[model samples]
Target: MNAEIDFAPLLPLEWLAVLAAISAAAVVLSLVLRSPGWALRGLAALALLTALGNPSLTQELRDPLPDVAIVVIDESASNAIDGRDAQTEAAETELAAALDALARDPDAPMEVRTVRVDRRSESVEDADQGTRLLTALEGAAAEIAPDRIAGAILVTDGQAHDPEVFSNFPAPVHVLLTGREGEWDRRLALQTAPAFGIVGEEVDVAFRVEALGDAPEEATRFARVEVRLDGEIHTVVDAPVGRTATLPIPIEHGGSNVVSLSVAMREGELTDRNNAAVFSVNGVRDRLRVLLVSGEPHPGERTWRNLLKADPSVDLVHFTILRPPTKQDGVPVFELSLISFPTRELFMQKIDEFDLIIFDRYRRRGVLPNAYIENVARYVRDGGAILIASGPAFAGVESLYRTPLRSVLPGRPTARIFEQGYRPEVTELGERHPVTAGLVHENAVQAAPSAEDADPGEGPTWGRWFRQIELEATSGQTVMSGASAAPLLILDRVGEGRVASLASDHAWLWSRGFEGGGPQAELLRRLAHWLMKEPELEEEALTAEVAGAEVTVTRRSVETTPGRLTAASPSGETLEAEFVEVGPGRWQATIRAEEPGLWTLTDGVLEGVAAVGPPAPKEFENPVSTGAVLAALADASNGGVMRLADGMPDLRRVRPGRTAAGRGWIGMARQEAYSVRDITLTPLAPGWLMLLLAAGLALGAWRIEGR
Candidate 1:
């Protein structure tokens, strides 16, 4: 409660001033003349002025408003590192207790309002956003006026994502870091990664191994650096600590290639969760070198030439045996236009230069000797690709299978040929294999083989073939079959190379639009790429993709579901992913990611990898708790930042113009805010009473003058 005196004058202040001046002049004149009646006149004038002016005493009942203080606790992903969570909880309890005591104090009162911020509330425009306490603090202070705000305090690791919110804060901001002293940490940093690179070429990756917090710079040296390409460990090197290293990575296939780099955990490290980083670089092919060899000038031979010529990436080297050694013509070689075949140049000279070699109905005619065949067989075993398009000759005596190439060939002809038209079909494995999965003939009028033409009542949309060589798969997967469900296409891997055989040479019949041409081009394209060791076409594999906090895992197989896959998080925790068959051979499942980093998935044999956030997440980039990021805000607001690990400092209330923190104490400003509840007014002196007093005083002074 408070009380004060107030006045209300009947006459204007200027008139009152004039009347007082006249009374002062009269008193001065009377003093000069030595007249006692002058005092009586002065008393009457004072009475008149007093009667015109009204005054009263007012008593007010006021309620003291508690000053508001905002306490922001950061719960971002990085804050969970080490023992920071426990540290934060302890500091919060102490601060709350201190604020409660301050509010209960008799002399001064304050209100503490706490707000917690985490990565969930952070702006997702950038996936790797750090702590966003400043923005949240602004919102928390929106309802309270500047004068009512005592101050604000933040408990975090000091990695703020938004700095603009600090420009116009209503009160001072004090930060309390939540990490212990001498915390050691080593994190991988990807300084530069390209978005695109040509296949078979080396891409440059610039990176660094940082030693942060209490870790010594010398600890960074001799640390094992692991590099993974497409989920497999490609290489390991001893990288220098605190320095940048350039890694030359070879692009494997034409697609997105994920590159993951990680540093080994150091002694007493803060956490290994942030030691790994990942990035993706798309691989594109520069050119496709294809060597197409045709034994004779057949009608379907032009089909192979046209398809290879249409693609700009394919550099086609085509040749047909215009005259075999078996030909007994009357004309001599000198008289006719005949060019010598470069068997030595093609077979042994630069065979490795070609990406693929296609054999279309070629028989031994003493042209390519046994040595040439042996060299070709050696080429396939040495990581080279080969595709055989057989004809009637494969079932006869001059079959290429009878040569040294039989070792790597997937299938052998059964000395029989189906000459009747039959619709081509994809085997169970083909439907799930990357090369044939979701394959469709765009202009095909049929969605499936005619119910009468297809077995099991369903099959792929395709054209009919006039003939196919009956064969049995010797080694490898039979991806496609022909008439009576005979093996038509077989894919195999021998040594380090790949081999595929299409039993029928009449595949060109589909290209000629026989009963509506099928996916001849697409089928041939995929087969050629699969032989070239395209990563996507693997018959059995695992792949993963990240979408925000969820990871989608896909398994491709020729057999049944490969049981349950295990995913190990960055924190070394395992999650079992139950597979659900989404297609013929593709099984998929999604798991929610709790944190951001390199996540690994494996199914006993094959492994897959995915990255949830940025290459180097901003939050993980600086895991060390420091006051630098929020120091400016604290300083500008007259507040200081301190480490919670040191000890919980005293919470004091300071004036707005004074410092808010010191060596052992952090303070909140005293707002001194209040509200008035009631007010009243009453007259002090009445007009009649003042007039009577004035009359008596005048009468007495006049009587004294006469005596």
Candidate 2:
């Protein structure tokens, strides 16, 4: 509250000065005459004149308010790694306790607000300590009264990725750091590899190796690195630390190749998981040429053409056997009805022109002699892919199963044809197999409502086909099963070529909506891709994906369920990890592969996954400290930026509108503007008697003077 005085007079200051001069004159005359009565009269007139001026007092009222404290907590991925999670937990506990104690104290007079800083899914590089602090302060000021907020405290590891954008805080920011100063000896890193590499070509991969922590300044360490191609060691080298090593790795084959790089940590390192990494590089050939041979015109003939035509890189030569030699459709000899089958030109003359041959619902229709089928088998044996989609004709007298081509087929067809509707299901071995894994009906279903909600009696849903050839399983893998666990799909390798056999020709019904439709296109697409040696379909594959410095290592196995994974660096140091089930039958593990080198990750069964080169590109690789990020906010708003290396500072009170940091915690000292309303005002004057009172006073004075 404040108070002041204001005075109002009916006469001007000049008139008052003249009256004082007249009184002084009277006093002088009295002194000259040696009379004390004149001096008494002059003093009385001066006192009466002063009483005519009016004065009033004005006062204001105010109430005190509480102050606020802002607490900022870091919740990024780095804070969850190593022992930092425990440190964060401890800091949260301490902060909560501190706030509770302050709230209970009678003299504290402070309110606590907390802000959590986490990774924003949209921006991976924006997680910084200073930005979070400034953001918290701005939020607190807007929500709470600025005069109520005292200061702020931040909890983090001090490893801010973006340090340039700090500033704009209006309160003091104190930091509570998490990690201790420890030696982090990491291998140098090469972070990423191109997705596709040409076969038999040399590709340059970028990588760097550095020695961190209390590494001997003058002493150098040798890291033995090995590059593996398709699970086999293709190249090996020994490189020194703290240098950039360029490795020229050759892409050996046209397939999905897994390349891995590993480097060993020093003897007394804290963690060994950062020593290795795995990369997946697709090996592509210059071109793919396919030869399509159709037995006759059928409803499903366009399916084969559409599948091959979808890929821009595929060059297709299609030939259809319109009429078999034995079928006598009477016509003139010179009539041009359809082109000849051209068996001699395609099979005997130019057999090696295509990389793959597809026989869609083909049969031994006497279109080509037995010798032509033999030649086709030889062509497949010498590194060609053959796919046979069979119809009911395969079980009839014109069965191709009786031809020389029968040897490459995964199953032998029986004369009997059993037709029934059945859902396509993965066999026991196919669940863990890469080609069919995660494709079963149960797995395809979205979220499971509950464990008990799964229908046990309802068989898998599949459309009914009018005809299915009975088949006897052979040496190759039985990838799909039907009612009573009968083989529906089979794949086998003959020499260097691959062959697949589907027991039913009615699979097109699934795409045609015969019952509830399924992902028919997806199924057929995966089947064709697997036959083309796509890397994601390998039965036993090792691959890893890198996010920042962390690598998620996955080992895909068709057989021999993997147990534990042991990753060894190029320097021969090994770190053991357990495989966690990520999906139905896949096992995965995450490791922080901080360094760049050849990392070899092997399970106990001699199978391994490797990252061929180095760590990935990251913005916050170097370690440095700068206060510029938070300086502007601290300076403009009178906030103090204190380093976590120093202990937490003492809290202080400051007057509002003053600089934040003066001699004490209180800002500059100044009184706040306050006022009280609803004031009462009453008149002290009445009307109609002023003239009579003036006349009576003048008459009395004149009478006294005359007497």
Candidate 3:
């Protein structure tokens, strides 16, 4: 309990002060005149003034409130290097013990609150913000009253990304750093890279091999960097360390083209995780140039034209055979209104300019001679794409199979035709192919036990084609079957090019909405893109998808038994990914990602790469720890940064403006905080007592004057 003098004024203080002044002057005048009762008069005046002032005594029942000392611990990725983790653990224990000892003090006690900031606690969205010790410190300080805060202590590697956040903090901030001197690391840093590029075009990428801290001379001179495109080793280049170098990488195909670069690890370096970097550049086509050759004006001819024209990215060049050279109609050449077909210009001069060539119901005609037909065959052999949409003429005497182009065609006509209507079915192989995968009718979806449980024999229930040309698939996989299980669609790879054959011309019926229609447009689009060598439409593929720390590995193949896939993590540890059949010819497995970096997966035949986080994790950007990051912050708060390697500092309490840190000890301010539990006010001068005192003093003065 504490007592202090307080006031409860009965009259205005100004008026009271004036009356006191007048009484003091009269007493001084009496003293000058040698009056006998001057002292008594002064005493009476004091009593009256005290009564008017209303003096009171206040007593407070108080409870001492403990000051708060916050300790923020750093456990980020960088803190785990070079024995820093153990150092941090030891420092944390020492600080906690010291704070506990201080809490036992009877006069000045403190409550210790520990806050931990680590990479694992950070969300995927905060992955870019490295170590945020200041953020955690602010949060802990906000939990208590500002006046009750003693100080903030951070036990970390001193690589705080947000160090300047606590300039005006309420109390001193001290840092106990981990890690020793002479630490070093070599890292691969991407200075500039494109997020996307045009397919088949060369894009310039700039990067640097960085040497941090006390890296050796060998690490700072020249380094061998391995560059990989789509998980396969593309090349090895000698890069000069500490300088940016530009490399030209060609975008192979459409879709994600991941380019990964990793430098050779140096001995005694901090970590190998920062020695590698991975980035994905999306490959996009400038424009899809398609050449559509129609043998005759058929009902399905306009369907292909309309579909290709609807896409803004496709540049379609169409031609129709109206008048062949063998036609015997006698007419003047000038009088004819037909535009001559530029067969030589399209088939011979500029055949390489087109990305895909579509022969819609086309057959061997006199307009395109045997020489032009042979040129088309040569075109397919040298990294070109051709799609054959056969009509009845394909099985007749004018069949394209009879020409030199038969060498590149995947199917051969059997001189037979099925005129009956039948629904097209996707073969078992098509279920795993990216183009035909996951395409099922609504009825098929409802009929299955579940969405993933597809019936083997079930196909899409849509409009039926009235006619199909019978063919023998000689050199390709049959993806679609027609009436009576006959090959309807065949896909094949000849040398570096691709070929696709669809043995029916009634696909336009579906576009006409006949019998509720079907996925004609979708099927055509996928088939076209697949023929153009789109990477996503490959027959066999290995890929990985990452969501947080979980990685899902998917293998797509036509074979029934796909062996176990081997995955190499960024840390160079190999893990086996077992497969379970999720659908026909498709298998999947999910595993927990051990760390964040580039992950390479291979199934002997195909390889793929997946990145679990950003191209370069910020935590590993500067692996060697030092006190430079938090030095300014500590100085601003009147604290010092000390290394735990020397020894744990002694904790002490000091005044607010004094130095909070010295060579051997760190100090926290003495807050002296308290709370008033209860307050009682008692009047010091009562009115009756004041009046009696005044009358006694006045009578004394009167008696003295009479004497």
Tens digit per residue, CA lDDT, model 1, 1-707 = 78777778888999988988987898788878898788887887788778777667788888988899899998886787788989989989999898899989877788888898866732223446666778889888887878889999999988787987767565778889998777778888888999899998999998888888778767856578899997788999888778898999999877778888888777788776568888888898888888988887898788788888988988999888767877888878765445667888998897889888988888777778888889888999998989899978888888888888888899988989999988877777877777776654333444334644533333455678888999889998888888999998888988889999999988787777777678888888788878877767777878887777778888988775777879887677888878899987888988877656677888887887776667766767777888888998899889999998788889888888788899989888887888889977656657888889889878887797888
Q: Estimated TM-score per prediction? A: 0.81, 0.52, 0.87
lDDT per residue (tens digit) for residues 1-707 in model 3: 99999987788889988998999999999999999999998899899989998999999999999989999989887887778889989888888899999988989988998898866623344566778889899888888998888999988888888876777777888989888888889889999889899997989999999899998787789989999998789999999989999999999888878889998777889888788888888899999999999988899999899889998989999987765667768976555545677889999999989999999988776878889989998899998999999999999988888888999999998999999989888888877676777666534544455678746355675678999999999998898899989999999999888999999999999899787677888888889988887767777877777787678988878865777878887778888878999987788988776566778887777777887777777877887878888888888878989989999999999887788999989999888889999999999999999989998998999899889
- Quantify how close model 3 is to the true structure by its C-alpha RMSD in Å: 4.4
Worst 10 residues of 1 by lDDT: 440-449
By lDDT, who's the top model here? 3
lDDT winner between 1 and 2, please give it.
1
The residue pairs that clash in candidate 1, if any, are none
Best by TM-score: 3
Is candidate 1 or 2 superior in TM-score? Answer: 1
How high is the lDDT of residue 111 in model 2?
A: 65
Off by over 4 Å in 2: 1-131, 137-290, 296-303, 306-316, 322-356, 361-384, 391-407, 413-470, 477-488, 493-497, 503-526, 533-622, 631-707
**lDDT at 115 for candidate 2?**
81
The C-alpha lDDT values of all candidates are 0.82, 0.63, 0.86
Write down the TM-score for model 2. Answer: 0.52
For residue 113, model 1's alpha carbon misses the true position, in angstroms, by 1.8
